[model samples]
Target chain A: MEQNLQTNEEIEMQLWEYIDGSCPINDMQRISILIERNTLWKQKYDELSALHTSFSTNVELEQPSMRFTANVMDAVAATHVAPATKKYINKSIIRGIAAVFFVMLTAIFGYALFSVHPTTGTTSMLPKLDTSKFNLSHVINSETIMIIVAINIVIGLVFLDSILRRKKEQQAVKP
Target chain B: MELDDTAVIQMVLQGQQAAYATLVTRYQQYVFTLVMRYVNNREQAEELAQDVFVKAYRYLADFKGNSKFSTWLYTIVNSTCLSHLRKRKDETILLEEEKMVSISDSNQAERPSDKMEQRTQKQMLENALKHLPESEAQALTLFYQGEQSVEEIGVIMGMTTSNVKVKLFRARQKMKDILQSRFSRELNL
Candidate 1:
């Protein structure tokens, strides 16, 4: 009886593997032969087959709301968009630009410093202008200054509003 | 030919944001069903599922495409549900609610006299599924419903392939035991 129980357990394992299509061909053939010869093996196989059939047929996929995709897209739009290319700004490109800018700035500053010789104690290379020739009053009016300030304030407020709106939209989407 | 998941992913990565909608629509029902296995709340499951898609979009660049997209997506679904379950940790309430739903279903089934036997058996199987440990139930569901191979299920569930096979075997055995006991009880009734 104990040996029979062990055999039954082994048969059950093989039957499961067979159902899953994981059993080797030779072992499957052996199980098939056993099923034909043994009443117990056939009964177990039939039961398992019925359960497998029921599971495959009756189990239905649960669906979400019709707006599920739309909601996801909206959430995506509200978030920061990823760059189109995987390498949006290559590190080498940025380094090369910075190197060029550094070299140009250094050369300009070196020339400016050397053009004014400390031994001569003169700023001859620098362009000279009459102080009276340039007047802030002639170039700008109080109204123009006020308009520039107002435009800056408006731009700042617009930027701040957009940032706040994005924050609110993100909060709304969260479960 | 229609675009495959990899092609759609490429499009999304290339800044064609609308391409992501195809992915969401294709997998919404699948992700929702997988989440429902753990959450058991339709509304919460839907929310979590949407969150899954949003996370996927945010992290699309991180996907190296080593595995199938469905396998990778299911990994996200598994982790999301796990964290949610951790926070909620209200198993008793959820089980009670599920029992109520089961009772209501059986009551409705009893009314349809002609199909009573079929409906009762189906309901019994469902209830037996509920009685399973969450891991076992999930394994069984992924195996049968997702049509996932053991290795794919291992990727989703974070188990070895052999472990997944063992779990599937035990889950089936437990389900059979539950059904047999329920059948005997119904006969006595």
Candidate 2:
């Protein structure tokens, strides 16, 4: 009997379903009976209902800033920049391949002109044939070719150096 | 009229990229309104709301329609606002500290007392909202201001209907307590 009463008077029964108009007819009757029989419950219901109405009606909802809509639209535009923007990797790889092609052309030009000269060095490319009196050393020492390869090595070193420097910088800046 | 939120969202997912503008126009007000409640600052709320909508557009494909469109949108807005609050520097206030100061002096100075009272009420309400736990505040505000039902609030909050009502009840009770405390002196009845 006590458990049944406790279950019937659960928190949900206090007022929410009644206020929400969600209580079924049977539950509503039970609540009505509770309200009629219990002064405290009736008073609490009146107070909560009034408070809900007061707060809901009296509170002024601040409209979002005037620029809100514009800003969101701008953001949407920015995200879809080209709608179907091409894949970045394809563009980057194409650029990389072009760079390699240019370097290879320069390497071949140097090999033909300087490696065949009757002077300086050995060709890294042709390790087998040595009959021509070409100065492979000239090509080997070819300042332009050396400069290009040296630049590539320097770039690689610079990139690695920057990465290490960045790591050290991050460590130094940590609290 | 702009495309409906669901339509634009669907179009954007289908790679009809321009459809995003329609969605933005359709729901920016609603999103901003939720964000404003959370952040309580116009500029910051707008910025945060914008960021949330942009994120939603990016992830529109993942939005399964388990809830109404507006409810789902607000869920995203609420999450963004909560994150914004987390990143803020203000100390949280308890719900018990709400005070209703008289705006009569301000009205006598220039404006009408009604306007001043309205402004005062707005400030008091905002303060009261800030004091509640984030979920309780969100649930109540969405329920009252957005006119959302228990089931709808439940969907937006990702809670059961009973849970949403519990939070709403607690939130309302807290707000009432605060209001009563603040106005007890001025109000006779």
Docking class of 2: incorrect
> What does candidate 1's lDDT look like per residue over A1-175, in tens digits?
9999888778888999988788899988998998899999999998888777766776677879899999999999987545434467688988999999999999987887788868865566677557697788955899889999999999999999867755653343232
Q: Kindly give the stretch of ten consecutive residues in candidate 2 chain A with the minimal lDDT sum.
A: A80-89
Q: How does candidate 1 score on lDDT?
A: 0.78
Residue-by-residue lDDT tens digits, candidate 1, B1-189: 779999999898888999999999988988898887787779999999999998888878767776678777888999998898888776534554465466446544543334335555556566667766677778888888877777777778977667888999988887766555455344222
Off by over 4 Å in 2: A1-13, A36-39, A81-175, B1-4, B11-19, B85-124, B185-189
CA displacement after TM-score superposition, residue B180 of candidate 2 (Å): 0.9
Q: What's the true lDDT of residue B106 in model 2?
A: 24
Which candidate has the top score in DockQ?
1
Interface RMSD of 2: 12.9
